[model samples]
Target: MHTYLGTFIGVLMVLTLQRVKIGPWGGTGGHAWDEGGHGASAGGYTGVRRMSIGSSWCVSSMLFEYDDNGKRVKGTLQGERDNGIPEEELDFHGEVLTHMCGYHDNHLIRWLQFRSNRNRTFGPYGNLGEDKAGWTRFEVSMEHSGSIVGFCGRSGNFTDAIGVYVAVWNPERFYDSMRRQGVRVYRASPLRMDLRQIEEEKKKEEVERGRLQKEIKEGRERLLKLRLKLGVDVLQQYQEIVQQLERGREGKRQTIEELQVEHEQLERERGRLRKELDLKRLRESRLEVELNHMQTWWSKITHL
Candidate 1:
């Protein structure tokens, strides 16, 4: 009987893994960030309740607000701002975030799109990167009756990378799975660092340290040989010119994006106003006809 019901749950309804983790997809330029916790309890449904994103030409920042087993969890903003772009808030209300897809340049996330359980599509938010050929697309989603609960990634001045944690959302299945197997649901916590994961992380850190050391060694060797080639003042002047050019280019791009967002808002306002004007004209026509009818009745009474 137990085997039969387990099979039924697996085949017909939600087959949930303890944790179905996807990726930290994006650039390698920033500090690693984790807002990962999928509310991995078999007692209740858990999912992202809302989200906010700040973007311009690139994704600047993101945050997730989660409802984890009746408790509210608000995640910190994941990245720094590159522009003065306003943040866009997406209030899911009660709907679950089911799917996410985005594109990333080698250095930063460029575009983001989202779909909810209500069949609503949120964005193709940022523009495609200038080098369209170099961008890579990625997707993370909940399988079966599930929900995406958390996010993790790398980010610097902009959102450099992104990822998600998925959990089964069927409240009935949670207790049934636990009771049938006497199995403990897997839980992920930043506080709980296992030894194998720690060792792997240490190895990565060592490799990065070695790479930086090698680069420094090579730079020193080159410097020793070509130390006298350029005067310090001349080098400073060159660097200043490069910085100026970079700042100017970046400033211009941001200005254009700001104007575009503002213009779109204005267009929507204009459409709303036009509809209101049409409604007002119809009301006036109706009122004018009623006035004529009253005047005609008054003349008949006076003639009598």
Candidate 2:
């Protein structure tokens, strides 16, 4: 019964996830701390190609790399400008940004999550701070037939306010639109690492991963060989013990059989002696009767 219920629940979940069509739900919700910085925008014609995010506990900054037709356009930095902060990169490969969800305190965004056009989800950057109070949930998705063109937000210290610009798949007027108010340059935020640096770091990590995988495989092989040898030794020891027990049982059987044979012979000898004694007693009685008869005959002759 539980198995059937689980299967039904699984089917419902799949159906619910598949309900999303090829476009956005158009909510595009994000977070902001305070509104002292300039309202900024980041996006392009073909939409966001990649993003670099810097964060720790709260989102520190973000930079967008856009695709203008086939050309690359770097969007200006959005947020703080300090260096050495850890950053996360989102390379769409070819997918476009479609939706976002986040958690934030009254001061700044604590975490941010994104979903691409292909339904790929990325990140919950920052943290759900120790004090959960004053934290609020924000979510947004494109409503109609458009992908996200760019981001517009107030910045400084951290991203203060955030919003998405959604338009049709490929609007030629996107350049003019960005000129008016949008993300145009793909410049790196000093606090956030650039895409080139990130790519190099990823390459180094992959090499290290390959080395670690090889070591793990070798270790497993050695461990397996040791286990097999130990198993063989244990089996041989048990076999010797079984062999000893079998020999001991055979010796016991032989001793019991010999003792039984001796006991049967003694019992037969006792029976034979008893029969001989009875026959001797009967013979003595007959001899006595004959002697009496002879004596009587002699006495009668004398008298005559």
Q: lDDT winner among the candidates?
A: 1
- Model 1 is weakest, by summed lDDT over 10 consecutive residues, at 6-15
**TM-score leader:** 1
> Over the full model, what C-alpha lDDT does candidate 2 score relative to the true structure?
0.56
Predicted candidate 1: what Cα RMSD to the true structure?
41.6
lDDT against the true structure, per candidate, is 0.66, 0.56
- The regions of model 1 sitting more than 4 angstroms off are 1-17, 38-45, 81-94, 129-131, 169-304
Residue 234 of model 2 has an lDDT of 93
Per-residue alpha-carbon lDDT of model 2 for 162-193, expressed as tens digits?
Answer: 65645442234433443454333232221232
Tell me the lDDT of model 1 at 300: 100
lDDT of 1 by residue, 88-143 (tens): 44343345566788898878999998887556677776786567797888775543
